[model samples]
Target: MDSIEPRNIPLTPGVYLFKDAGGHIIYVGKAKVLRKRLASYFRPDKTLTPKTRAMVRMAVSVDTLSTTSEKEALLLEASLIKKHRPRYNIVLRDDKQYILFKLTKRHEWPRLTLTRKVVRDGSAYFGPYTSAQAARDTWKAIQRVFLLRRCSDTAFRNRVRPCLYHHMGQCLGPCCLPVDNARYRAMVGKVELLLNGRSSELLELLQQQMLDASEALEFEKAAELRDQIAAIRRTVEKQAAVLGSERDMDVLGVAETSKGLALGVLFVRGGVLLDGRNFFWSGLGLEEAPEMVLSFLGQYYGPQSVVPQRIVIPWALEEQAQDGSALPVMSDSLGLSDEEVLADSDDPLAALAEALSELRGSTVRIGPPRGDAENRLVTMAQTNAAEEARTSASANVEEILAAKLGMASLPHRIEAVDVSHTGGRDTRVGVVVFEDGKPAKDQYRTYAFTDEESGGDDYGVLAAWMRRRLESGPPWPDLLLVDGGRGQLGAVMSVLEEAGCGQLFAVAAIAKARSEDSNRADRRKGGVADSIFLPGRMNPVSMRAGSPELLYLQLIRDAVHDYSLRRHRKARAGSALAGELQRIEGIGPSLAKVLWEHFSSIRDMADASEAELAALPGIGPAKARRIRSGLAAMRTKA
Candidate 1:
């Protein structure tokens, strides 16, 4: 059968490898004592799963990576496992998607922005904030607090006019105006300190700035500064202060129920629990107590993003902590000696057995807490794990949305459309998709109106786009959303009915408020109150704000607006280019195409000399002179 044998290597602190019968390294383990530790796997199984038995059956040979101490071995184990991600090991897949604070470091006045991806090429980064809303709020706070530059590099370099951001008090207009480099760098340094939990220092500086502004009779600016300082102070005061604990510490707690196992981690940075997350895995078969804990720790700490000064785990991880391959241990409380702290003599089965027995409503035994403090911490860990599990369940959302909206389905997929243009000048349509209550960006589409009556005919633009979409035959959608009230809906419904596709999907229209302004901040201001006009209903289904359906509806509308505006802007640029080229006597559609392809842009064509224009494929010397003259005339007018 399985012909694997232990190397019987001395347990003088080293890394060990377990190879399957086929000589594939199935699992790698480490221990302080070479002989006594490696021999424990052969003992009678307590509650090992079929998977563990299978792994054992495949074990053919053992290998070791010798080290001077168990700590070194433990260190090495974590490194190798991170590199390999062995099958038998626990894998914690934490969502890496987080908000990033991007700063343009190359510019003299770097702009601060919130982005999803971080490129670490000398730019400053702060965050991985839990939510996009939270990130946006923080960004707004930063702007009010420190008026950082927000322009793009190209805009900053060539800007001649102060933009709207300057008037709104959001940007300092450093792009066009000169700013002292020393002062700008100082602000950057203060941002670094503020993010690093030195809010006290930042507040002091803000206080002085506020005083300076007030004394200079800049009352409005001083009031704004005061508000910003208060916001920063309020946020800092929310940080939880641990009793006599160092600023940096990672607290680990493990809890298990019949449903699965949970590892709850509390990361304390600068003595504050800014954020935390939970990890859970199906506990099908758990044989060795230390090994299970070891496996979970390996997966949890594999990422380079988070590393703590000290770790507090439930059980000893000696074999794991040795060769820098495992979870490093600051200390262990078991009766094992200082040297044996990293040894494999400790057994946790008795405590787990008692806990499981109690959980099963039977007599059980467990390790007594060293003190009440330790016991309370353990309970807190268990509560945190349970809460994390409950919060992360995806099933409840569907049921909740259904009950709230009285809908057959959760309305997981929604399609929204908005038509954009000024007086139908550049009539363009935007289509947006929302899936599972969020905007599904990849499914967004846009349509530029080919035929439309000039000046304010919403129905005409919508009808054209609708007809084109039907003819083009894009993916059929779960729902069709119209941005206008009755007019847009009537046009869309009529087109679909003509195509014999009226009953193929749900159609609804969201109309803006008639009396109240559409752009107002008041949620209730917008109308026909965002009424959902169903296919047959002469009116619309009205829902209250904060309802899940209402929230989902708002997201769809917003996404469509964003898409429509972006498409409209691009179409406007294209139209402007075409109109400019059309003015040239020699530039018909063919000559326009040649000029567009040759120069790649309207600006380039306009900037080109007569010689460069003559060098183009179809432009003769006489035509080039005409082209240059036309461009010169447009530039003069502009």
Candidate 2:
């Protein structure tokens, strides 16, 4: 495959996908010079890391997409990684982007909200904070300090008066009345500033206001200001440290070992380190540490959100350009200028040499960090990196499942399907998608049973719905979960074969718990145990009912069932209404619905003359007379 050819590849920026013999994508990468970068792999370079060597050997074909720029490539890479999650790529196992605050601004008054889910509607969003607890705490702090409401938009708009939050002084009532937009905007600005680490500036302004109020003998107002000031001070003081004048800088520190590498990036904002995250790159060696860390930083910090005014690194690498805000790479030499250290540090030849030596599992001694401050930064980085690697190495649910099941990669994007019906009346199928081990409700789909009878046709219903889904233009999943055993699996296989998508997706089935000693209902006491069935497998895989994976699967199945049931009820109700009206001889659902909407009460229909009924759009003279006669005759008989 390597000898096949490397001709006619574009030199533009883009993400490249490398696949193995089995057509599974093994590696994904973004490159500035796609042709040049890809050509290097086919070159006769004998020295490559064990990981890269394995990736290269598996690489039967390479695919590329042209992006506008490197930044575009980076974004495309992240998105592709999210979609396919190639095996030899670094996967962010945890969903760090879930911690968002959704402010229900469509209300009469804007409210503070903290949520892990975000829909890309017109609503205001405040974060991708690392921690849910942190987001909640900040939300509470905003409510206390800013006095914003916390009610849903529906409740907020319809409220006749302020609620308990207002009486408790946690909200500035805007539902029943109006607040100046400028004032509210000012409060929002202050909250933004506080969140963005301009707390000191906000504190100084509040202090000045408090002093002014005191001088004016507005003691009550002054007291409130004092309390707010105190609260802000307490919040900031909890995480305080004396950062010497380096206002906006990012500290890059790395910890390397024989097995892998861990990189810690500390983002310092306005003289305070706001947050730091540790990343683990498995199977990387120590000599390759500098280049690996450099590559990761260029990719990770290159995103707009984390780019700081200055970047402080333990060492520099090839691709970094010279800038005034770039800090010196720490070294043993005492007498050196920052610019010279930076220029000398970023030599690409050194990085390549390091990468070669790194494959042999040998430790290369770099310069020692100077001063306690520098050492502390390095220590924090090392500690965090080690802990992060340890945490990742430990027993993760997805990892365990993948290893045990011999799957291609971690089963993150799981999909579950279920059917619901009410005895030959209303039937439907539910399709739900789960991402990063949680429900992504926006991707949920439903299919009404149009091809089969409402009930007693489980296999037929399943096959029809599966055919519809295969025809639908949604992305194929990593794993498909069905809420039944072999019968259901067989039904779906027929659909897959008919639709010609047999090799496009993986399939699994979850069977309901059966009783060995007890009846089905009695088995419900400890909750229904479930057995997962894989395609072509005779025996089902047993899992504890309350385990995270099983529970997650159950939740998806239940969601589908619930959605299907809801649709079934609606369909049954509509069908019953249609049946009742059909007894009138000429009226079907469309005409019955028209008469029902135009004249809500039967008495109103009975009172209408033939001319009046004929004036209705769908009702002609004949139908109008029939309606009038039917109503009158029924009333007379009664």
Candidate 3:
């Protein structure tokens, strides 16, 4: 389908995109010599990596956009990749799936849900949590400290009776009961206070309220406040100041292996190390240190990225660490290849900083950290990256297997897929990873189906999920292992075909043997065989259950199932409990949701003064009183 002949192409600097049959852009690139680069794909005798061949095969058309110079083309290519996320442009993507806690004011009970992106929607999003577990722990603590509903709108609507969470005292049975809207709103406030990292202010307010209640002879209210104060203090004491300055900055450190380069970003906010992230880049020929560093800076500081006035690279502090000794001696220790020598006309780092400065409407500096304390911080970031790359040296797994996987070099990364659901509800896809035969736990990601209708369709769920992931692009695995038989394997292959990156990675499927002639007793003992299915094969490749390849596949499958199943159960339970708040007479679904977002719990919502309740739209003075009366009745029932 690739109909364009290379001879027809003009020699010029420009960016080009390869589009699939559906007119979807699959790959984006830039070329100083368009004819030469375009001709390389058509050369029959020239050796082509499987990845390049795959792109060429699926591409039905090539669309070119000419630029004035190569630098302009380079910048345009980066921007297009960011927008289109063509699968081949892996060097600039950071799709690590950090957790973001979302609380929407649109709901009556604004319970927290972990989301991936921070949208401009009115809801508040707190965190770039390094892992889902960290976000889970924070959400759990918030629920434990303040009993907010953990159910979804759908679950809340269908409840006939209070669920386990309500009985366990983690939620007030707002559904199927005469619930208090005002009290629920208060619980939402407490959770927000904790998430906003205003624990000290929260503690002071609780203390003041407790004192007020005591003076009013409300002993029970005072006691509850006292406990809340203690909990806040315990949480606040755990976050120690990690830096000497309160100025916010991003610290960058680089680690390199012969195979690839890794960059560690330490997010320093209010001088506290809140979260850390690592990004990897390879195969764009970033062999030279300066070019790699510049590329990293450009991609990282692009328009959408959050930026501070100053950026610190570890090598910037290399000289200071040596107490003013020459730069070269310190550079080597920091994994920096050479002194800050500028050989090329294109100053990408400067261009990046300039673009950032334009966006920020202020000058932004990209260089080393300034003080003794700052220098130590940069060193810390560098060390973190070094730890990640230490294992990268072993990223080259068994070479034979890598070749089979159709990798350009060796398989440094492998991602396994598993989908778990509860009766077409809360379906979640798990993307688990292994690097050089060892687990990469931080990279484990799960995507829950947001559509209720798509729960039962595993093939559809996976295809859609994989497509979205690839479109976000990068950190693409060298190999893929689907947790099913040929059906799932074929589904994955078809998805890769649609994305135009099928030949880039090796693909396989793992399936448990059918009973065939075996009895129930044999099945119970794990006597059934495991099958490994490779692409282009009619039947699964033969491998014994005890074989290393089969066993490793089993481990990956087990982990994905476990990881996804656990989250599914929790989400299902939460969705069921959150629906309860809508039962309040004065509040409908929309009002209930907003109230949930605004207030933390039933008690908080019920205790809110009439004036405060009136401030919320649609809740007039009469409805406010009704809300209070309902809360009082619910209080009596509980």
Best by TM-score: 2
Better of 1 and 2 by lDDT: 2
Q: Candidate 1 lDDT, tens digit per residue, 27-93?
A: 7666657654554454333323555556666777777788886655665776666444344555333
Model 1 segments more than 4 A misplaced: 1-40, 46-51, 58-87, 95-97, 100-128, 152-164, 212-221, 233-239, 243-246, 284-289, 301-304, 314-316, 320-381, 390-638
Model 3: what TM-score?
0.53
TM-score of each: 0.48, 0.65, 0.53
Backbone clashes under 3 angstroms, per model: 31, 1, 35
* TM-score for candidate 2: 0.65
Question: Each candidate's lDDT (Cα)?
Answer: 0.62, 0.64, 0.66
> How far is 75's C-alpha from truth in model 1 (Å)?
8.5
* Arranged by lDDT, best first: 3, 2, 1
Candidate 2, clashing residue pairs?
A: 424-455
The best-first sequence of candidates by TM-score reads 2, 3, 1
Cα RMSD, each candidate: 15.5, 12.2, 12.2
